[model samples]
Target: MNADTRALLSEAFAIIDGIPDDAIRFGAPRSIKGPTLDDGTVCSPEGWLAQHPRFIERGLRLTEDGSAILYRGEGSASVPAALPMARALGLPLDEARRLFGQREEFTANPDNPLTDKQLWEQRVREVLGKAHSPRAEVQELAETGSLDPHFGHDVPL
Candidate 1:
C-alpha cells in the first residue's frame, strides 16, 4: 500500500481506538509474527504487517533448523477465514487486546528469532521444510543468522 493509504488507515484506527472497548468486538491492533529488526528486535504485529500489504494476505509460516531460517508467506497470505486462525497457532490474543484496548495487533507472538540462527535453521529445514532458492531473500535472511529453515525444502546436498 502507498504511504498515503497507510497513514489514512493508521489515523482511522487512532480514531477507532478512541472508542470505548465495550462498543466493539474487534478493530485495529491485531497480532501477527514478523521479521526481526536489524538490532535483533522483533517487529510488533502492527509494524510487521504494515511493513507490506502482502503480510495480511499471507500469514507467515515459521520453523527453525538451528542454523538457516526458512520462512514462507514473505509475500501473500492464505485465504481469509470467517474465524480467526492465529489462535489455532497457539497465539494468545489477549495480550494484543490488552495493549490496544479492544484493538487487534494483526500479528502474533514469537515476533522474531532472538538470535536468528542455528535452531532457526533446524526449524526451517526440519519444521517448515522450506528450501527456497539459496539466492532468495529468505535464504539471505537464513544466512544472516536471522531465520532458521525448517519447513522449507533444502537445496540438493
Candidate 2:
C-alpha cells in the first residue's frame, strides 16, 4: 500500500479501537434506536465510521449494505457496513467489504469466536504486517529492541 493508504488504515484502526463494545451492534448500519452517540444506540463498524467526527466533518454518510433495495421484501437491508470505511480510507468497496466482513465473521462464528479486542488486534497486525519491510523490521528490532514501533507499548505485537 502507498503511504497515504497506510496512514489512513492506521487512523481507521485507531478510530475502531476507541469504540466501546456495548456501542457496537452487528448486522445493521445503525440499530433501530438510531445513530445517536448515546448509550442506547448501537451501530455496526461501518455505521460507527459514518458517525465518526472526522468522517462527519468530511460529510460521510451511512447506507445499508444489503440486497433489500433490489427486491421489495425478500430480505431485510442489512448493513453494508464496509462502505463508509471504504470511502473514509479511500479503499475500494469490495476490498473494505472483504476486510471488515472477515472481522465480523471472527465474532459472529458460534463455534470459535474472537473478542472485539482480539479482532481489532488481528486486523491491526495485518495492516502493520504490510507496513514493515522484512529486512528493515529485523534491523529495527536489533537496533531498537522492538519490532513494531507504532505500538511498542500499546499493542502486544
Candidate 3:
C-alpha cells in the first residue's frame, strides 16, 4: 500500500479500536442493525467515516434501513443513492476492497460465542503482525533485497 493508504488504514483501525464492543455490530459498511447507538450512530465502517472529522462535509449517513451510506442534506445526491463504502471513507478502491476482505478474515466470527473486544483486537493484531513481522521482513529482503513498503523497518528479529 502507498503511504496515504497505509495512513488511512491505520486511522480507521484506531477509530475502530477506540469504539466500545457494545457499539460495534459489523457485517456491512454500516451496522446491520439500524441506529444502535444512543446518538443514532450506525457503528460500522460507514459510521466510522461519518464520525470522522475529515469527511464530515461529505454528509454521509446511514440509510434508515441501515444498509448503506448516502449523502444527506445540502449537496446530497438528488436520488439519495447509497455511496460505495470506499468512496464514503475516501479510500482508494483497491485498498478498500482489500481492507474489507481483511476485516472479514481478521475479525471474529459473528457466530462464535467466545468472541469479544479483546479477542477481536487480538485477531486484528495477528493479521497486522503477519504483514509487519520480522519473518515477513526477512523474507522480503531475501526475495527482493529491499523492504516492503510502509513504516517500521527496525522490527526485532
Candidate 4:
C-alpha cells in the first residue's frame, strides 16, 4: 500500500489533539526498528518511534480511538478553543503566553476578557462540555500562586 504521509499526519495531529496534557501516548509500546548504524545502535531498537509531523496526526487519532473504545466510547472532548496549546501540553506557562502572542487569531478583548489559559478553557468547554472544566480550573490554579506549575499533567519519572 502506498504510504499516505498526509493522512498519517492528520491522524497524528488528531492523536495529539485527543490527548490533552500529554507529551506522549500511553500503553502503546514504543517500537523503533529499522536499519543499523556503526555505533552498535540497532538503528531501530526498543521504543523506537517517530515524532515528526506526519506521524503525530495519526498517533493522536489512534489515541482517540483507543481511549474512546475503552472508556465507553468517550473520546477527548473539545479542549478550550482559545486555550494556548502549550498549557494543554503542560509546557511552561510562558510558552502559552508566547504562543498566544503569535497567533493571528488571538485578539485582545475588552469585555469577557480571558487570560491565555482562560481563553483556552473557554474554547474547550464549548466543545467538550462542563465536565472538562476541572481541567480549566486546574489551569487557573497553576497560573495563580496557589498551584504548582505542574498542575494538570502526570509527572514522568
Candidate 5:
C-alpha cells in the first residue's frame, strides 16, 4: 500500500475503534422473531445479512453463499463474524449451527489472546495490507473526496 493509503486506513481504523460498543447489535445465527416491518417483510435472522453491504463498502465481504462474512482488506483475512455474534447473543456454537445451518469454516480460535475489538482491528490492518484492486479504488475515491468518511455506519463488522 502507498503511504497515503496507509495513513488513510489508520485514520479509518481509529474512527471505527472510537465507535461505542453499544451502538452495534451483534448478529446471532438464530432467527429473531419479531413483528413485520412497515413494508411488511418478516424480520428473520437472515434478514440481518442485509447489513453486509455497508460492511462490504468498508472492505469486508460476505461469503458468496451468504453463510458468513469476513474482512477482505488483507489477502482474505479470516475474521469470522459468526464467533463474535455467537458471543454477543450468548449462543453456543452448536446452537448457532443449528440455526444458521453451519458455522463459517474460517473461525478464530476461542483461546486466542486477543479481545474481539483487537481482533477486528488486526483484521482491518490485514485487509489494508493486501494489494487488492478494490482497496486501491477506495483509496482513490477517498483522496478525491468521493467516498464518505463514515461509510461504515450501521456496518456489523
Candidate 6:
C-alpha cells in the first residue's frame, strides 16, 4: 500500500485494537477447525485478534491453509458496528465501506501472496482520493441525527 493508505489502515487498525472488549460483540468462528492458517499455523481466533484486533467485529474464518480471513458476510452486524471506527477516524461511511470492500477483495484474490499488504495500496489510494465531499455530508447527517436512517442510530457514529 502507498504510505497514505497504509497510514490510514494503520490508524483504523489502531482504533479497532483500542476498543475495549466490552464494546465488542464477538462472533462464533465460521470454521470448526479453529484459527489455523493455510500454512498450518495453529492460533486461536482471539489470539490472532490480539495482534490484528481489527477483526473482532469484522468476523474471522480460518482458510483451508489456516490463515484468518476477515469478512463481513451478508446480514452481518459488523458493517454497522464498524461505523464508529470510521467516525473516530473522521472518515465517511462510504469511504470506510470502500476500504473494507477493498480488504475483502484483496483477501479473496488468489493470484497474489496472502500477506501482500502493499499489493492493493494503489486501489485503496484511488478510492480514498476520489472522495472529498462525502465527509461534509456525513458530518451534516451526524449533526442532524439523520445517520440513523442510513448507518443506524444505535451506533455512536
Clashes of each: 65, 1, 0, 22, 3, 8
Superior candidate under TM-score, 2 versus 3? 2
Estimate, for each residue in 1-157, the C-alpha lDDT of model 3 and write its tens digit.
4555444444445545555566565444445333233333435544555545444554555454554456553223233222354565555555444444324444455466633444444543453455643333344443663322231122211
Better of 5 and 6 by TM-score: 6
Candidate with best lDDT:
2
In model 2, residue pairs whose N, Cα or C atoms come closer than 3 Å (at least 3 residues apart or on different chains), thus clashing, are 65-80
Question: Model 5's lDDT to the true fold?
Answer: 0.39
Candidate 5 structure quality by residue, lDDT tens digits, 17-115:
543432222343212222322122221132233233333454444443334444442322143454433333334545333332222221346566554
lDDT of 4 by residue, 13-87 (tens): 332332332222122222222222111211110011122222232232212212111111223423221132232
Task: For candidate 5, report its TM-score.
Answer: 0.28
lDDT of each: 0.28, 0.51, 0.45, 0.28, 0.39, 0.36
Work out the TM-score per prediction.
Answer: 0.21, 0.58, 0.47, 0.21, 0.28, 0.29
Clashing pairs in 3: none
For candidate 1, lDDT tens digit of each residue in 82-143? 11222222223442233222122332443533322222222223322244222244444446
Off by over 4 Å in 2: 32-36, 63-79, 102-104, 107-109, 128-157
The TM-score of predicted model 3 comes to 0.47
lDDT comparing candidate 1 with the true structure = 0.28
List, residue by residue over 1-157, the lDDT tens digit for candidate 6.
3554444454333332333322322232222232222222222222233223233334432233322333432223334423433443345667654544333543555555433224233334465455533344445534665333221112221
Q: Which stretches of candidate 1 lie over 4 Å from their true place?
A: 1-41, 44-51, 59-114, 128-157
**lDDT per residue, candidate 2, 1-157, as tens digits?**
6676655555555555556676665555565453235545565555655555455555555444422111112223453545545655777766666556544465456544655544654655565585553344345333654322232122210
How many clashing residue pairs, candidate 1?
65
Cα error, residue 92 of model 2, in Å, equals 3.6
